[model samples]
Target chain A: MTGVIVTTINLTAIYALVALGISLTWSGLGFLNLSTGAMYAGAAYGAWLVATNISSNVVVVLLGGVIVGAALGALICLTVFLPLDGKPNWELRTLTATLALSFVGTNIYLWQFGPQFKQFDPLFDFIREFRIGETLVQPSKTGTVIATGILIAIILAFISYSRIGLGVRALTQSVEGAALVGINRRTTAFAILGVSGAFIGLAAVLLGQIYFVEPNSGYSPMIKGLIVALLGGLGSLRGAVIAAFLVAFAEAVTLQYLGGSWVLITLFVLIAVVLIIRPRGIAGVLEGTRA
Target chain B: MPRGREDLLHYAGLAALFVLALAVPFAFGTLSILGSMGVFLLLLSWSISWRRQGGDTLAGVRDRSAWLFWGMAGVIAILIPIIAGTSYFLAVMVTFLIYLSWNVMWGLVLGTAGLQSFATVAVAGISAYVAGYLSVELGKSGNLACVGGGERILGVPVFQWWVAIPVAVLVGLIVGFIISLPAIRLRGIYFALLTIGLVELARAYVVQDKCNFGGGQGLYGASSFIPESIAGDLAGYQLAYVAAAGLAALALIIYWRVNYGRLGLLLRTARESEPVAEVLGTDIVRARLWVFLISSAVLGGAGGFYIAYYGSISPSFFNFSTVLFLFSMIMIGGINSPRGILVGTMLLMYVDKRFVDVDPPEARYVFIGLLLFVVTIVARDGLISIPDQIRRRRGVQGRGTNPEGDPPEDVGAIEQEAHMPPGSRPEPS
Candidate 1:
């Protein structure tokens, strides 16, 4: 039971890492970035490239994810967003464009990395055997959960407090005001998109180690992240993180108790019921997004 | 302002095209003439409706004015096959008519109202499941129960022929109203997401019960509820289809007529500024509901017709991608344009269906994503609008006007007032 609990925590934390990044981009850019799925699959492949062909240092693999993901994210923002200049129909354009790009990215990665699954090593097995009163827990996944959640929360708080964070908030408020206040809209928007992409990359690397890395690995997480954000409240940073772990934990529990297919139907129903009742989400935006 | 020879020529062109549509099956032996015609008519109708609305025009169309000439040319081109002894092509024309039936309603809800939705396909899916289930249950007993009513279903005889269509239509109204209840609260894409969620929900619901709807396993043989003995043979069903289509099309024309004048202006204005419409004594909610309910009836009517043709149902038929396709149909054809809806569906659906090699079902998704991407970028208004663009360019050239000079002066001033300098203003690249 303890071992299973550890794995669940690890999975939930890993999901939060990806969901946090996705929610930030959505709040800033005003659409779910479908490309994160591709970037994730790319990261797993990237890890494989380093692990097999070069040095497999844990830090090195993660850095590879960040580099590849950031470059791709930056490139897409320039190509798709800048040219369009953030058109009014962000929901449609971003969804459609990123969706197409995801396909191309997936195909290219599939060709490069091949279609089968590949295994990679985790940072460490820290949940081995810990005695607490009358019980001892030995699970490799427990450490991952505690460590990942702490790391993500810290990163998010740091960014939110930073000057760039202030600029992002201002940009979201009124694009014109931000520029007038001497915030570089282009650079600022790029930073938000990039940082979000980087987080997704990190999550991808983590997932690759925990599970089998395949071409289609990112889609489930990507979709889960989107639902988490929406379920929490679109554009709420903290809500997405909290919702992420909640949903992950729910899925884990459902899988443990019920069946896999039932989880989707149940989650979908829960979301529909909530959204219909309160469009703002579980916690209203004003409550969640405070200065 | 005036209907002239050009307008006459346009209708004549439609007739000629209709005739040619009847003739095409003989020309291409492999082609299902009705399917081809259904697709073609869909495009034609889309073109007609979209052009009337001030929908988006890209690739230099920028709102071309000469709709009559294009309409006429379309007919003249189609007339050749009909004149060449291919009246049999009319059989294929019915298929295209069916497309128009559904899409027109979709244009009303999605296009005219500016209420973004993605649930029509799902509604169609639910109705399809309802339709197939009813037809199949009636069929299983080998009873002519579907043909009228010897067998009473809850003290009401099972409807056959035209009755089934209405039953389906009523169900559509129910589904539409159910979806509308949710749509009232949600904004644009949120409404769309809700629709998708409902569709998934419907998919789940449809797959569960064996008595009402055949599960994912699919419905077995279904009878065409149309009374063939009275109509004659297969050609008899054609008459019913055309008659039904004629009525539906006439209904659409009436819809268009209502929309063309003061009432339409009221709705259009309402879409841009609801408060203004409210100030002007328009019951915004009632007017919206009016259009919504009317559109639902038509959508339901279309679903009835589709079941008449397919004679089967499976939950698999309706999904997210179908919604995407419907969106593309309107977007590619023209927004808020009835004719454009028809033309766009035919042109895009045909091209997509033909060119797309969907050997694997998964590949179909990637194919559609790519298609939507390309079309969204190249012609956001849809393919039926292509001719309009060409015509506009021709007019611009006729005037000998020099294009591409000034950045609209008002844009800069507006940006400046918003506290963003012109340089820092959004790049209109």
Candidate 2:
């Protein structure tokens, strides 16, 4: 039972980190960026390459991941979003374009890194394991949980207080309203995307410590991010955080009782049920008009 | 040139293209680059001439010209197997036809209905699995002396392929209906994401259940629709080609009927503006449901054909990449054009087949992805609209109107207006 709780918490933290980016992008831009998974994977590979070749320091590796992910996010904004901004059918066009970029990024990963899995040197390996109520807990897992919690709190605070974050919030409410208020929509969009990308990059570093990273590693995490973001409501940061824990716990319990293979099947079924019951999601506000 | 002479030239061009398609297969091998290039050039020129004659419209001259073009295409399709004269080329042609069938079904939902569906592969997988399982079960019963040499279902002998096709379609309709129950609640990108989740769920269920689904090793030794006695060697390939082509023709006919009929109008109306469609008293739900059922049924039938041709089914065969490839083909060709589906499928499949020989196998994904991105950005209507886009860019005023005669509304503008707070609706673009 304790093992399950620990695992659930750890997963919830990591998933929340990933979901933050997805939620932010959706609310801020009204764009469903499907390339988050590719960004995650790219960040993982970037961190792995840096750790293996340059320095084993945790900070250096994490920074490398952040830079790579932010760059990717910015590049997408410039190449796809910037050119097609304010166009007719922008929503569908951007969605398809991001999906294409996702596939292309995965293929690039396959070409450069090959199909084999790579891992970062464990930063917390030397730390002693702790026992909580007869359950053995790895320090790395605990470290990740703590670190992710801090990151989420910081992001929440940043979004609440920062000027650019306020611009993002205004855009989320109404793009025209934001423009009327003199917010630079283009620059603000770029900044929000970069910050979201940095979150995904940080999540990637945390995830890479727990599992092997591969060309296809981004897909599963991307799916998880999507589910959490939808479950919490597209733009609700608090809801995403809460829903992340709920989903993580559900996944943990399912994994324990139903076995490993059934986890994804159950998750999908859960998502379908949620959509059926509450199309706007648990925390989503009604758009009050036909979408 | 006079209108009569221009029409005459269009018909002659189509005839020459048909003759070229017939001769190319025999002149060089089917896979030869020269043959492919020659056929591509001829088809392009023929289409341009047809378009120049305004064949897309319903005018009397264009109507006859449309018939002429389709008739020539039909003749070429019929001549392919005979001209190739080899099972290898026949097999390739069969693959192309099968993909075309898949795309035509997709075009109905994604193109006409404006639903971004990712469930085609999932539905196809279900159909193929059912057919393969039934064939294996019957084969087992026959070996046990429970039935005669002919295929038997529950101790009753029957034409297995005949049973398989309809059953697959029925299953597809049922599955499509069930998916739609949850699907119709979501809008836009959410709907597309839900389909992706559903697909992943189905794949997981298949992979995890080894006993029934054949697991990772997959099922084999299923009976083929073509009997060994009649289908000796190349004959089987020829039969597959003919069956697939027939199916493609049927799909095209269905596509034509839907696009030109009352159903097409309702679907397009709902797609463009659901609120307007509702105000007009259209039963949007019924229209969408019918689209789903028809599309799913066709996809299921194609799946049955797939199992018949390959004699096996596996989870890996219907993975995410397969769905993406199908989507890309439709998007690149022309989502709204039935003919565009054929052209897109052929072009992408050709690129895929040739890319197999490239040093790094994965590079093809990048190429395909880039193509999809570029096409989506440069030509919002896909490859079919490239000519129109060029004409517009060349300052051809009044030619910017879509062939369908509907003025292109700014989708973003409408969405923004809809979501804008009361008293703040933007002025209509």
Candidate 3:
């Protein structure tokens, strides 16, 4: 039972980190950003390269992931968003374009890194494991959960209180209204992309410690983030965080009882049911307003 | 010019195009790339010239030209096997025709009806599995002898290629109808996501059902559709090519009928604005459902043909990448035009086939991605509109002769005219 709880919490933390980024971009910028998964994979590879080739320092590796993630985020913004700005069907165009980028990004990784899965041994070796009531636990998992909690809290506080966050909120509410109020759409959009990318990078580094990083590793997490974002309501940060935990718990319990394959089947079925019942998602508002 | 002379010129142009198309394979020899390019260029030039000769608003003339184009293209397709005279070249043609059929079906639902369905591969997979399972089951029965003097109707052989095709198509229509039931409630991206879910569920079901569906390793050795006498020869390719071309031609006709017919206009209107269509008393739900059903049946039939042509069915072939490829093909070709769909499929499939042989496999995705990106940004209507874009640009630069290049006070007039019926002038109030 304790193992299940720990796993659920750890998974929830990771999903929260990724889902937060997806929510921010979707709600704030009206961009689905399907390449978030690619960003995650890219960051994992970036951190892995740093740890394996340069130094085994955790900070350096994480810094590499952040830099890569930010760079990719900026690149997507410039190429997809900037070029097609002010178009009639900008949202759908960007969505498809990002999807294309996601495909290309995964293939690029496969071409450059070969097909073999790589591990971040340095990070794994550094983390210490402890036992609690006959259950063995890795501090790294607990550390990740705690760190994610802190980061999410910081993000929540920033979004709630900061000036830039206010600008993002305004933009999310209404693009025209935001423009009328003199908010710089370009700067806010870029900032959101940067911050979301960094969050994905951080999540990637932590996830790489637990799983093997490969060309296709980003696909599942991308799907998960998409489901969580939609379930939580696009652009709803609070709903995203809560939905992450809910999904993580369901996944953990399903894995514990049914087996591995049933986990995805059950999760997807659950999402379908939820979508049928609530098309706007758990916290989604009516059509006009962004969550 | 007189009407007779104008009509003569049109027929002459079409005849020249047909002759050029027939000569392409012979001129280029066994290399399919050059042959494909020559044919594509010939078609492109023909279409461009046809568009430039735009004075014929008479529906009869338009219909005749359309038929002429298709008829000549059909003749050229039939001549490909004889002119190319190689199994490799014929195989490439077969692949192009199959993709052409697939994309046209996709264009019906996605392009004309404006539904963002990603379940083309899933529907195809379902049909393929049905065909494969039936073939295998019937083949097994055909190998068995009846015991104890009992008539064994259940154990009788029914795995003929001809039998499998109709049964698979029927199964496809039923499955298509069933899937579209729930899909009618969903809209846009939500509907797209639902299809994705359906695909995942189908894949998982196929992968897990080891007893009936052959699980992951996949069932093999289904009897080939090609006859035993010419199974390994160029005749087999020719047979497959003919079947594929026939299917593609049928799909194109359906697409054309839908686009030009009343049902197509209703679907398009629904796509543009569902609320407005609803206000006009159009059965939006029924229209979407019918289009979905037709598209699904077409996709399912294509899948059946694929299994027949390839002699096997597997889950991996119908995965996410397949969906992406189909989606990108429609986008690249111009979703609105059947001709664009054909051009897009041929262009991308040719490039992809060559890349598989020459370049690193990963480069294909990058190339496709770049194409999608460039096409989405540069030619929103796809490569089909590129000629018009070029014309507009040249006109803008040269003499500003085209009013479309820079409409000063005509914006409001254009907007107002868009809502009015064609050939109906506004009342002078």
Candidate 4:
């Protein structure tokens, strides 16, 4: 049905946004950035505060979330990444630092906002949806899909063509080589993490309109993002996009057929089966990306 | 100092600490106060031997020393409940022991095998759930069939505290095997991420299925060491402490056997370099799988003890917070050091118990989080490695040579080398 299709696309867009954030950071910075979840929650709260106090305009709300998310990302970069960059076990150490960051961030949110769920007012009331074959599509979801598509396209283009993106690509390929080319690793890392954090923020804002935001809101999405990133292979952008759709489809189908609780269970089973068949994930098989 | 004098000093310090631990009950005489003193004594003893890595190479001395340390610690652990004379303190110690055992097994996977897996909690959680369900069901039906108050399964009583331990081990092995299926194909972050997802899966499945998994309240009325007739009495507390201490001893033995045994050597080789290990004819995957299975069994036993200790199992056992707490404990302890893990567990447990009275409970987590963040940045190997770092700084001893021309054999160095992307490693200038 059109309703299910719309939902699936919406879920896919959100997952892609999160997955792209994870994938980009891992490739560019050699850090897993598990704190993405905290960033997502922080961004959602930012968007919520903006919508509640300032303006409910879509662009304003989105920017509010993106800026807060980017700031938090940069915060993590400053606190965790910069000090530990190039250190021994940078990957695992950064991962632990990020995990610790999330723990701190989540608790801060809990302390400040309390544990109650906050709902977002409709941000896409101007949009209209058309019915197809007795199934009515949701306008909010339609807006999310279109908005996320444009944002992802813009991010991909930025990563591929922009000067900073070039440096990030170089860093991803080889840190020493990028250094030799005079790329400021610290500034470049900030840019990379900030952009990815913005991506997660945007996803959180888009999803906020659909779901309530809370302190622990980002944990599930972070898990979903990790699933997509893992199945797509850690650093492969194209693979992440493809895996996003795959995971979203599986999640949507399971949610529809088995109920909401079964979504994660089904997706995990899917990842397990897929990863068993191709250990490196779909991207590892298709693009031969490093695991 | 001469070697003989150094050895004498170590024993003298350990003996003095044993006396201190023995004196803890009389000095503080209360739950929190007494527990704090006991923890401090344990830390002091651990720190004394922490820098003596040289002694670790001498198997006989190390074994005898470890036995003396653990044996004394075990005695103190057993006596704490009786001396405290409060069921409340016993309950806290029991929980601490469970987490200690659980974290130790997790250390095996993360430290020894060098796989950053998070399914340790999930394995233990599953074991707890299964053991609890089995005990409840078997106790109800088997009691009727046997015409006795207690039922026996494999010569272990269905409702007994120790019964869950073995059952949990079996469940853990099965779950560990299943989880390790995809583990063979994946390595490093990919595998770690997968394990995290698995934890989420287990949590969601348990939470969503209210009918089967008891919804949010979780499964209850499972058998424990404490009898219903005297569940609130001092005897019940003593029994629980003794059972937990026994489980902790078993876990320590398992950790020692696997970590010091040939499997640990094989894993060290595989962790150093997979291709080289393959060239040397070591089945890296099988070795990891074996490690995973053994650790999982230990985790399962811990989980089994959890149900018996608490008389219930909940979805929160598989929570993200639980994972963070356990991970922080291991990381703080020096993920690779068992003795450090004990230190980490004791420190974190004390901090957690100490902060239980703080208002706006989130502050406690923030404090713990800040502690973890600071430690991760400041000490690469955790609190346990600080002494070594200090010694190195003062030029007491120089860095050891790596005969294989590899990076320094520190925890992070090896993990970094093992997981680095092919071109990402800096070329020799």
Give interface RMSD for all predictions: 4.3, 2.6, 2.8, 2.8
Candidate 3 per-residue C-alpha lDDT over A55-98 given as tens digits, one digit per residue, 9 for 90 to 100: 97867887788778877888888887777766544655776788
After the best TM-score superposition of candidate 3, give how far the Cα of residue B168 lies from its true spot, in angstroms.
2.2
Answer with 2 or 4, whichever has the higher DockQ.
4
* Cα deviation of A208, candidate 2, in Å: 1.4
Q: Which residue runs of candidate 4 sit more than 4 Å off their true CA positions? A: A285-291, B1-29, B33-72, B141-164, B393-407, B410-429
* DockQ (0 to 1) for model 1: 0.24
Off by over 4 Å in 1: A1-11, A32-68, A86-147, A150-166, A202-223, A249-258, A284-291, B1-100, B138-163, B208-212, B226-267, B356-371, B378-429
Best by TM-score: 2
lDDT of 1 at B302: 72
TM-score of each: 0.73, 0.89, 0.87, 0.88
How does chain B score by TM in each prediction?
Answer: 0.66, 0.82, 0.79, 0.80
lDDT of 2: 0.76
- What is candidate 4's lDDT per residue for A1-291, written digit by digit as tens? 555676788898999999989988888887788898999999999999999999989889988988898898899889998888756556567888999989999999999999999988888878897787887777888788888878777877987899998998898777778989999989999988998999999999999888899999999899899999989987888899899999988887777777887888888889888888887778753332432
Listed for each candidate, the true contacts retained, as a fraction, are 0.23, 0.77, 0.45, 0.79
Cα displacement (angstroms), candidate 4, residue B235, comes to: 1.1
* Pairs in steric clash, model 3: none
- Candidate 2 lDDT, A165-213, residue by residue in tens: 7888888788788989999989988988887898899889898888889
Locate the minimum summed-lDDT window of 10 residues in model 3 chain A.
Answer: A84-93
User: Considering DockQ, where higher is better, how would the candidates rank from best to worst?
Assistant: 4, 2, 3, 1
Give the poorly placed runs of model 2, Cα more than 4 Å off.
A126-128, A288-291, B4-29, B32-69, B141-159, B230-232, B390-406, B409-429
Off by over 4 Å in 3: A122-128, A157-162, B1-72, B141-156, B388-429
Best by lDDT: 4
Top DockQ prediction, candidate number: 4
Question: If both were scored by lDDT, which would come out higher, candidate 3 or candidate 4?
Answer: 4
